[model samples]
Target: MTESKDVNAGSTASKERVAQFNQRFDFGSYAETRQFLDELAELSKRDDYYPDVSFGKTYANISIDGEGQAALREMNSTFIADMQALVTKTKN
Candidate 1:
């Protein structure tokens, strides 16, 4: 699949969009996951980026692309990278 760039998120907003998302969003062990949330918030603020944040008691999701399913078609790589980093860290 062709990767999208310069779509909605620049090169910076990916984490902001992702970080703000996972903050209030639930993920099971809320206490242990504090570091992850802090990392996301720091990355987002540092990069000066913010995405559509959806918060719920049980779950939440973030969108770095434009909006809806179509925007996701053109996902910025930075978002994926950041997410991967988080995943890798958790996995280890």
Candidate 2:
């Protein structure tokens, strides 16, 4: 798994204890990117958790956010695990 940094650390929003995780992934093609996004959507739907997602032709940027202590831990762990799995699968 790649190390993810807190992109929101210095922002004013961080004062509220809002946590965000950001990661970028590359896909072989646009079709693969779309497929990955669809998979992410399915997983998010199952977990009832959604992230702010954006993608271009062959790359995707995913950001997950949470606002409270417990929520932050849960959201970050789940998102990291799921995203790591997705990244591994797509790379193979």
Candidate 3:
């Protein structure tokens, strides 16, 4: 999967047009990053929508690519929103 510098996520139409969800985030610390990854792992298990996650130090790069376009689009939105929530939660 390719890394995207564009932080502005496209609309649902763009998600439908693409076959993958790619985004990068910074969690500020190793511990915070680990917490974020743990949350993601649990989410993947619960939703059965696994993603490609790479991280080091304080940054994480995530990508999910597979079959089922509809499911993928939904998962993309869900995952991104949850991740954003996690970031907000951690900040507070």
Candidate 4:
């Protein structure tokens, strides 16, 4: 089975939520946000888990994942901790 599978079995029991994120980073005004998005994109690339991205004046709904969300919490908690560490903002 793929390491990407069934991870939710070991994750949080929170109901699925639509969220947004904004934050401060190690650079200019919105640099952290950009870095957050860039790193998220990079992580998605590595795991073949791309999400939708929408840019706006003050925020971006940079999807962290898609339909396969049942296991997202698990993936981030375990297999993709590196990716989890990079995201410092979330909206719900």
Cα deviation of 45 in candidate 1 (Å)? 1.8
Task: State in Å the error of residue 58, model 4.
Answer: 3.5
* Deviation from native of the Cα of residue 73 in model 3, angstroms: 4.1
Residue pairs with colliding backbones in model 4 are 19-91, 20-91
- lDDT (Cα, 0-100) at 79 in candidate 4: 21
lDDT per residue as tens, model 1, 1-92: 12446674576465335332232334555443554556666656655565555544434455554332233334432653574477447535
Quote the lDDT for 78 in model 2: 68
List candidate 4 stretches off by more than 4 Å.
Answer: 1-28, 63-66, 70-84, 89-92
Question: Higher-TM-score candidate among 2 and 4?
Answer: 2
Query: Where is model 1 poorest over a 10-residue stretch in terms of lDDT?
Result: 15-24
If scored against the real structure, what TM-score would every candidate get?
A: 0.44, 0.68, 0.65, 0.42
Each prediction's whole-model lDDT (CA) = 0.49, 0.71, 0.70, 0.49
lDDT of prediction 4: 0.49
Clashes of each: 1, 0, 0, 2
Which candidate wins on lDDT? Answer: 2
Better of 2 and 3 by lDDT: 2
Question: Compared with the true structure, what per-residue lDDT tens digits does model 3 show for residues 11-84?
Answer: 44465465566678887789888888888887777777767778899998987654443675765647557766
- Indicate the residue-level lDDT of 89 in model 3: 80
